[model samples]
Target: MRDPVDKLSAMAIFARVVERGSFSAVAREMQISQPTISKVVKALETELGGKLIARSTRQLSLTDEGLRYYAECRQILAAVDAAEHSFQSGKERIAGHLRIGSSVSFGRLQIAPRLAEFLKRYPDIDIDLQLNDQNQDLIREGLDVTFRIGELNDSGLIARQIGITHRVTVAAPDYLRQHGQPQSPAELSAHNCLQFNLLNSQNLWVFENNNKRHEVRIKGSAQSNNSEAIREMVLGGLGIALSPVWLFSEDLKAGRVTAILSDYVAQSLPIHAVSPANRRQSARVKAFVDYMSQALDAAPELKPVR
Candidate 1:
């Protein structure tokens, strides 16, 4: 019989195998032979006295016991990582891979442009920036941090409010000239409104003026899940859009688009740097979030209009 193995190491390997969904993939990641990886997991199962993984030619799956064990393993591993991270000193602690997520337009316009300077400051760090319109599971995607716009729905995340997305109702000059400017919130119904379908209330627009509120349900010729696409539609003179002020700040200055409904206030969304609550925040993640918060605070377009 084989002597007792390092159970913590074996548990980590098992977790990675399940996370990657392939034994070969985990083996390649750890730079170990595939058989050795399999043996480690098998040994872990043997010691635990139950099957952890069911393997086939196509994929790997967890049994009921494995699922529960895997969940506990993740929490324990994260705690270990956090404990180790706490011991490293100063800038030395901030060295590692950071996986970041954000919406396409925000990532492109705000985060991507600032990365060069951030990289220059922390040369030891590497970043993987993933931009998508859909709000996918951050833990499943292995994201260390994500920039979320609007009110957060995921109670499982720990969020820090980094900025405000001050919204505006805007249209291209050509569109306004053709459709006429909407003088009041109620008049928006007479115009073509572009909707960003990702929001729950995409078709419903709310405005406030002098303690009075107006809710308008609008219809349009176009609807897109992406904010960039909505911006494009507004630029093409197809319709008016209610979007973040940063989205069209340059366009507003350049006369490409005009901000209407000045008498009323469009709802502003909060920008948050979110992380999985179960995982402890690493130094790199904290550093990045702090840098982003400071950078965004200085941005004029993200500031709330008084």
Candidate 2:
């Protein structure tokens, strides 16, 4: 039988060396001699029957075998840590790491502010938030949950629809006065349309009129991948923009921008909390989703745009 102490020591040292990229760094961190770290690594490689790392005087790199081994080792270590944490916390409270993925605007304007409240309610839970406009692969990235603002296209993931987000065409009063307002979707072609480049149909603005939906292809002088930047530009009277009403409700209400094409409204996109189907019942995952759902329901700023 293998010695548990030796196995743990080997795993710990391996992880440290991989992270630090050198045996000397691990030795300095552990306050042990460099030779001792090397010995442990060599022993681990022998036990596993694979050369996990290629070491040199200048640099270190993992072999293909090492990369695969490290991936498995990391997962195993995380599971062990979670198990220990669960035992210590008595399973009554939400604990361990909860990684969340969300779009930049929604994450910043809505989700992030409520994070402190969540922490206060569940002190044991640690949150790691990743905010970007790009859609990420949740399972591959090891995310516990994600906030998606539009239609979910991934068939394998489970999505819980929390609320709906309306789309609107908005522009500064100055821009509308200077350039003239668009009375119909066709007239939008003559105006400077500020486009959000991340959307699947970036050039097309969808509008609904009397139960009929119309998609108008719009040309824009200004375009950006960042949604916040687009909103800022629109607020500054650079051009008209099509975006979710929730993103610009404050601006709309404060008279910074006016909603146009009011007669031809767009359909509301459902906001969803998505996760891998397999982890739908996970305690930490469920806790976060529930917390966010409640927080959103109570937030006055998230009210539907009329």
Candidate 3:
């Protein structure tokens, strides 16, 4: 039996094993032996009095109990991370350069607007903000942290859901007045939909009604690879646009852009703060992500509409 101090390490190893689906993978990543990894998991299952993983020759899969346990483990690890940060603040300024990657529109309208606060809080830390509307290899780009909006499939990466963001269909009141509003997702096909040419909503828009999903294929004369450009075209009365709500939240409230088809649920795209999977996250990276999560939670624009 190991000391109580080693129990947390074992729990983390168990979580990583479930995440990676291979004992060897976790062992290689953690720089520990394969037997040590197996022993940790064995000890965990022994302590819990049940099997967490149903291991086979090919891969590992979590049992029902394991799935529930994994969720609790992740929550506990996050709380431990926060507790660690709370005590380390009085030491010195968290001085480091953060190379962050994000979408151009989100970096400009959302993240950039909040930078002054982060900079003010961490005077010694500097940020290298790279804004592009495409996915880049995190390690190859040498980024300290990157914010992505979809599922994190890589076992080598860690994801944190900061808040929820969803695709919103919007139109300038003038344009809506001219063409009349789309009463349903089916009506959008007849409208000149401004395409962002990115993500799932590029040439297709998705909605939910009566617990059934509707995917509408749309076309328009104007298509932009950038989201902000799509916003500009929508504002110009070029046509209606399906965009992230945060891009035009204030406009929806101020009546500049009208949100139609309220009965159908717009596609849900939850906001995420992703970083490469590491047992220890840097002070600057941790601080920035935590601050962003808090900021996003408080923002009315990023919230999902019922």
- RMSD per candidate (Å) reads 3.4, 5.1, 10.4
- Candidate 2 global lDDT: 0.82
**Steric overlap count per candidate:** 0, 0, 0
Tens digit of lDDT per residue, candidate 1, span 175-194? 98887998998999989999
Alpha-carbon lDDT, every model = 0.87, 0.82, 0.80
lDDT by residue (233-281, candidate 2, tens digit) is 9988899998877788889889999988889986567789998664434
Stretches of candidate 2 off by over 4 Å are 1-45, 51-82, 87-92, 137-142, 156-158, 276-282
Candidate 3: clashing pairs of residues: none
Deviation in Å, model 3, residue 61 alpha carbon:
36
Candidate 3 achieves a global lDDT of 0.80
Ranking by lDDT: 1, 2, 3
**After superposition, which runs of candidate 1 have C-alpha atoms over 4 Å from their true positions?**
1-13, 20-47, 54-61, 79-92, 304-306
Off by over 4 Å in 3: 1-93, 152-155, 277-280
